[model samples]
Target chain A: MFLQSDTPVQLVSSQSSSVLGEETIVLQYEAGMYYELNEMGGFIWSLLQASKGMTVGQIRQKLLDEFEVDAVVCQQELTQFLDDLLREKLIEATAPAP
Target chain B: GASPKKVYKTPRLKTLGSVK
Candidate 1:
């Protein structure tokens, strides 16, 4: 998975995301991919939108504070979810600055 | 530390399609 606790991530410029009601819609024009992120997905997307290049650990802390879940499970699921986004070319993850 | 018990739904992405 591309997401490490210290890995920083930001949304790709080719994509545009908007929130409608409870769901967030991401449109990737270059690839013509339209994604619908709901529930936890929406939350994560919003964070990335607000702050560019936030570390995975920071995002996870926000999730842990807002939601009730075991740390292991949260990490596992968050990693998988981020992997999917990476595979889909919606977000970009980078190593933290030294 | 028992707060209100809750379940977290794993974030999911549903791709509509690639633009033709």
Candidate 2:
């Protein structure tokens, strides 16, 4: 596991707001605290979680089976999400896991 | 060769600093 079980993320959902929006999510990521995702975010969230330490190629195939989203859309959205997560240090990414 | 730089998610006093 990329993250040891002891270093688990603590998710504080959007309880502060009644509606969870894109901008709200962008603002909600708290460092040292993992995010609890909403519906749409959940799909993307799960993909990244399962893809930890795996190649992006593997992530693509798994996403295809898991959601009705197109490969291109999946790639684009997932990429952006991952990029933000990386930038935020919410996840630690390796070099494609060889 | 360089250690990774740490970026502060919120530098403003209001965001996470207001945690109560």
Candidate 3:
């Protein structure tokens, strides 16, 4: 599913994560699967862990500020990452407040 | 002022399989 820029996302309750060096390891309890996130992926995961309902746009801006990547590339990559998380049931997205 | 040279890497999420 395509996540809107303003949509808020939070980690699913059935998982636990650990940050080891530059990588973040997440275990989905229900699926009994382990996900390894690289440096950039770990950075995004850390953001979500720190804040319970951060928006996609907020994440994109944080990436832009922390890295030298182009804005378009950042948005595209972030959306893809979040989409993967959503598909794996590691995270859930909420509709924007009306 | 010079900014950090780190470019955003395409975030990778590797599934390592169930631990059971």
Candidate 4:
């Protein structure tokens, strides 16, 4: 599924995560699958764990604020990361409220 | 003035196999 900039995303309830040194380890209970996320990926995961979740644009902006990266590159990398989580059912994205 | 160094590494997600 193509995710728009405003789409909201959150971690799925079935998944759990823990910090291991610089990385985050995520476990998908139903599938008994383990996924490893690098430091940047862990930061994004924490944002999604927020009660209100976060939009793709919001995440991109946060990365820009916290790191020195080109806007276009940030968006591209963020999109790919989120897409991977979505594909693995680690996260779910919702349409922005109309 | 020089800009801060770019610390951004492309975010990655890798599957580490299943518990079962």
> What is the DockQ score, from 0 to 1, of model 3?
0.79
**What TM-score would candidate 1 get against the native?**
0.89
Docking class of 4: medium
Could you tell which candidate, 3 or 4, scores higher by TM-score? 3
Which 10 successive residues of model 1 chain A have the least lDDT summed? A1-10
Ranking by lDDT: 3, 4, 1, 2
C-alpha positional error of residue A24 in candidate 1 after TM-score superposition, expressed in Å:
1.2
Question: Weakest 10 consecutive residues, lDDT, candidate 4 chain A?
Answer: A46-55
| Deviation (Å) of A79 in candidate 2 | 0.3
* Model 1 clashing-pair count: 1
Query: In the order shown, what is each candidate's alpha-carbon RMSD?
Result: 2.3, 13.5, 1.4, 2.1
Candidate 1 clashing pairs, residues 3+ apart or interchain: A32-B19
Per-residue lDDT of model 1, residues A1-98, tens digit only: 55689999989999998888878889998898898997789999989999999998999888888888889998998988888899888999987889
Over A23-61, each residue of candidate 2 has an lDDT whose tens digit, in order, gives 233334344333334455544454544444554456556
Top-scoring candidate (lDDT): 3
Which portions of model 2 show Cα errors greater than 4 Å? A1-36, A47-52, B1-20
Against the true structure, candidate 4 reaches a TM-score of 0.92
| Greater-lDDT candidate between 1 and 2 | 1
As for lDDT, the candidate ahead, 2 or 4, is 4
Residue A77's lDDT within candidate 1 is 86
List model 4 lDDT by residue over A37-96, tens digit each: 999999888888864668899989888988989999999999999999999999989988
lDDT of 4 by residue, B1-20 (tens): 76675599999999999899
